[model samples]
Target: MSDNQNLLAGQRRALILDEVRRRGGVRVSELTRMLRVSDMTVRRDLDALARQGMLEKVHGGAVPVPEGRTHEPGFEAKSALETSAKYAIARAAAGFAAPGGAVALSGGTTTYAVAQQLVEVAELTVVTNSVRVADVFHTAPRPAEGGPARPATVVLTGGVRTPSDALVGPVADAAIAALHFDVLFLGVHGLSEGAGLSTPNLAEAETNRHFIRSARRVVLVADHTKWGVTGLSSFAALEQVDVLVTDSGLEPEARRVLAERVPELIIADAEEE
Candidate 1:
């Protein structure tokens, strides 16, 4: 190819990466039209990017690569670490639920907080992979005297359990695939600009991704400590996130970046009683 052609290809590829970063993923067809290039050329660009470990080529698009190392702590351990923040975040997220709504909760301490607050919501169908979360509704009653018990039904996924109390694998996937949710209250091991929403265990990541797709809206409940850490597998990115409810502990600069990427970012005041 001539110098100009080479320069144009490089520029187009750069633009594609930029688009993916901003929107989480970019389709081959969209890139072709945006670049004024042929479909074959767009695929070649994606192929090149994929080869460099910059992105992963999916069915018709590419997503960013996960950055940094990530690990998971047991459920009880994490629950003790961020008691107030999780409570605050959970309260904020629980407010989103409506009566008779189907809400899915992925296994995480923050989400367990959400589940705790959710007991006030009457008749909500709660699907979860965590035994602890499911137990919240086992015997919940409204605050009123002899008030009616929360008619909420908790569906626990059938799968192998993790130390974090998350059930994952084929059984969980199949169960999640058959159900749909009005909103998904998700918990992640970490969130960074590069890695997006990630988890330490590969199976949990897969289960989380399935939950993400099963819901119409994704509401993330996380604390600031999740900002820098990364996980082994990333299930979604800012583009995929519809709402993020985090704690005030997040750094200023991280909030700025998240605001730019996520459509709705709510930094819950964990300190407020």
Candidate 2:
């Protein structure tokens, strides 16, 4: 390419990186419109930036690299990403929730999806650290006056709230220590073979460990995008996971590897729901 073309590409990539830094992430479609370029151009820009390690390319978008090991995006920042995949994973994870059984749910956008799915389960006692997840059940419609009032009982742990809307720290850990669950639907910031399940928040990581210990079965609910991403703090290893419920977006090789690590792996079809 000529110097002029090279200059233009460099400028475009700078703008793309700026947008990602500003918004935490940007979709190719959005960038195309913002940059007044074709989708192909936007994708190429993303590919180039990803190669430079300036931003991480997700399924259809690019997110700024986490600053060191402690940087974390807020709930709203992450809520818009991987929506269909999250719902699909939620559907699969919710199947593990038995009727009238106790379940623990950790905080994250994906676990919030799982919480939405669990609202209809009868007589469920859901213990959760996510304010958002607890709201899913709290705001659910009540049964008719004459009908049996069998709404899921939600216990929101009290603690300092994190960027992802998770109640963490000492209070949250103490509450979880007294409770045990039949299953725990845990959501993580990142997962990998080396670091296992991890999060940028140190306190949240400690609280998640408590959740893991209190549950008879640990069901990890994460999308394909979390693969190979390691956070600041590691909570559980892949081998400790009783089951993994992820979306079909996971690559076949990853599926094979995860199947070997975890006892059960459930891949939900994102397009189906």
Question: How much lDDT does candidate 1 score?
Answer: 0.83
User: 96 in model 2: Cα distance from truth in Å?
Assistant: 0.9
Q: In model 1, how large is the Cα lDDT of residue 183?
A: 92
The residue pairs found clashing in candidate 2 are: none
Instruction: Give stretches of model 1 more than 4 Å off.
Output: 1-70, 142-149
Q: Name the weakest run of 10 consecutive residues (lDDT summed) in model 1.
A: 1-10
Tens digit per residue, CA lDDT, model 1, 1-273: 223244466566766776886698888888766776778998998898777666789998889775455445567546545567788888888888888899999998888889889888878999999888887877665457676547457899999999889899999999999999999999989899998988879998889989998999999988887897778888898789999999898999999999999999998896676
Name the best candidate (by lDDT): 2
Q: After superposition, how far is residue 11 of candidate 2 from its true place, in Å?
A: 27
lDDT against the true structure, per candidate, is 0.83, 0.87
lDDT of 2 by residue, 1-273 (tens): 223233477667766776787699988988777777789988987887777567899999999886667878778656656777888899888889888899999999999999888877889999999999988888888888876555457899999999889999999999999999999999999999889999999999999999999999999999898998889999999999999999887988889889899999999998986
Q: Which residue pairs overlap in candidate 1's backbone?
A: 70-230
